[model samples]
Target: MKVLVPVKRVVDYNVKVRVKADETDVDLANVKMSMNPFDEIAVEEAVRLKEKGIVTEVVAVTCGLAACQDTLRSAMAMGADRGILIESSIELQPLAVAKLLKSICEMEAPSMVICGKQAIDDDSNQTGQMLAALLDWPQATFASKVELAGDKIIVTREIDGGLETLSMALPAVVTTDLRLNEPRYATLPNIMKAKKKPLDTIAAESLGVDTAPRLKTIKVSEPPRRAGGVKVADVADLLNKLRNEAKVI
Candidate 1:
């Protein structure tokens, strides 16, 4: 079986985000970058499946600027066989991204595709579902555990109330949750080897998909800063404030 995992590059989670002075997007100047944490888990799962002899090959793919190659390399270092990059500088909406991925899926025709539940930067949990819809394939989102049996895939998902298991046929899509597995760090040797791995770059327009931005960002602003409150000396002071100034009691 061939497994395709989609990865993404985003701002490092530890970075303190700042809005651009123009208020159009986040200020990325001098910001550190890393693979989206969820995508790392997706790549790790694909690699583990290959290591266990459950899958024959693992392919990592990404869509974004050239910098996204870093994320692809990170996946390759984690044991994906090769990488495909859909190069685009403009930001793509979920639908556009799904359309591009659908094009690649048609060409690759992998047995299964895995991706993060959401990108940390955007927090838009739509790409995996949209890709599944475009491909007309079974989908298991927020999967905490995944196993293969015969031609079927069993997925344990984290739902609102608790966990739920679902079975889907081959050529399905699975979006991973946090507890799927602890992602492994790339060893020094693996990181060096990843540089020699095949990393193909393709133009987004070449896929014949509309890579246009459908949504407009009308305004961007920082969230209000939290204010520090005075500590009351006793229950009487707290009650008095709540009953008078705060008017909550």
Candidate 2:
């Protein structure tokens, strides 16, 4: 089976994101960018499947500007056979991305597709589901564990209360969650070898998908700073304050 893993480049999780002075969007001028953490788990899972001989090939795909090639290279370093980049400068919505991935799926004909449950930047959590809907495939989101059983896959998903397991037939979509697996670091030798790995870039427009924004962001701003807590003289004072000022009572 051939596995396709989709990745996204976003502001590094450790870095503090700032809103632009004009409030148009988040400032990215000098921000450090890296692959989304959840996507790393997806790549690791695919590579593990390949290592186990369950999958023959792992193809990494990313959709975005030219810079996304770097993200694809990171995946290649981790053990993907090759990469495909859908180049576009426009910000693609979840639907647009799913449509583009659908096109790539038709071309690649992978046995399964895996990606992050949600991109950190947007937290939309819609792409994988949309892609499955587009391709008319079964989907398992927030996957913590996956087992290949003959022609079917059993996935353990993280839900609100606990884990839920489901079995789906082949050619399914799986979205990885944080606890799925720890991603391995790309070694220096593998990083060097990644340069030689085949990475083909195709224009997103050539996919014939409308990469337009369905939603508009009026402005981006920092969350309000939390107010300092007050020290009460006793439980009665606390109750009084909570009942009066806080009005919880």
Candidate 3:
């Protein structure tokens, strides 16, 4: 089975994000960017499947600006056999990305597709489901554990109540969660090897998928600073504060 893993490049998790002066979007000038942490888990899971001999080849793919090639290379260094970059400069919303991945799926005809549940930047956990809908394939999201048994894949995922397990046949989609597995760091040798791995770039338009934004951002601003807690003299003071200042009562 050939597994296709889609990764993304996003603002580094450690950096303090800033809104642009115009309040249009996050200010990315001179800011560090890296692979989405959830995507890292997806890549790690795909690589482990390959290492276990369940998957014959692992292909890492991304749909975004040219910078996403770097994210694809990072996946290669982690053990992907090759990389495919769907280069597009347009604002890539979830549906646009899902369309691009659907195109790739039709082209590559992979047995399975793994994706990060959500991008930390947007926190819009919609791509995987959208892709599955477009392709009409079975999907499992927020997966904490995945196992391939015979011709079926079993996924254990987290839910508000507890854990839920799902079994799907080949050619299914799975979106990874944080608890799936820890990603291995790219070793020096692997990094060097990744440089030589075949990395193919395709113009997003060439895929014939419309990369258009459907939603408009009204504004982007940082949340207001939280007010600090205040001490009270006794129960009566606390009650008074909650009933008046806090307005809870």
Candidate 4:
């Protein structure tokens, strides 16, 4: 069975983001870029599946500028057999990304697709579901554990209240959560091997997916600074302040 994993290139989580002076978007010039942390978990999960002999091939795909090839290379270094890059300089929203991925899915025809529950950059948490909808396949989101049995896959997902378990047929979509698996760092040898791995680049437009922005960004700005907490001398003072100064009784 072949598994497809998709990753996104974003500003490194550790880096502090700054809004551009013109309020257009986050300033990315000369900033550190890396793979989305959640997507790393997805790649790790796919690699683990391949290591367990449950999957024959793990293919990693990313859609973005030419720089996104680096993110795909990271997936290959983590044990993906090959990499596919849908090249586009423009930033794609979740829906457009799902559409492009749907096109790739039709061409690759993998047994399943693995993705991060959400990308940290957008935090939309919509691509996997959208892709599953577009593909008309079963979807398991926020999967913490996954097991393969025959033609079906059992997934344990993290929900609001507690863990929920579900079994879905093959050719499903699984989105990784935080506890899915800890991503392993690529060793020097593996990194070298990844350089030789087959990586094919395709123009996003060739997929025939409309890559237009349906939503417009009115403005991007930094959040308001939080006010400092105030201290009260006693319960009486606090009550007095709450009733009079704070106007909340």
Candidate 1, residue 120: how far the Cα is off, in Å: 1.1
The regions of model 4 sitting more than 4 angstroms off are 232-249
RMSD of each: 1.4, 1.4, 1.5, 1.7
Model 3 pairs in collision: none
Q: 63-145 in candidate 4: lDDT tens per residue?
A: 99888999999999999999999999887999999999999999999999999999998799999999999999999999999
| TM-score of candidate 1 against the unseen true structure | 0.95
Tens-digit lDDT track of model 3 for 1-249: 999999999999999999999999999999999999999999999999999999999999998888888898899999999999999888899999999999999999999999999999999999999999999999999999999999999999999999999999988999999999999999999999999999999999999988889999999999999988788999999999899988999
Best by lDDT: 2
TM-scores, each model vs. reference: 0.95, 0.95, 0.95, 0.94
Model 2, total clashes: 0
Candidate 1's residue-wise lDDT over 115-227, tens digit each? Answer: 99999998999999999999999999999999999999999999999999999999999999999999999999999999999999999999999989989988789999898
Taken over the whole model, the C-alpha lDDT of each candidate is 0.95, 0.96, 0.95, 0.95
- Model 2 lDDT tens row, 116-164: 9999999999999999999999999999999999999999999999999
lDDT of candidate 4 vs native? Answer: 0.95
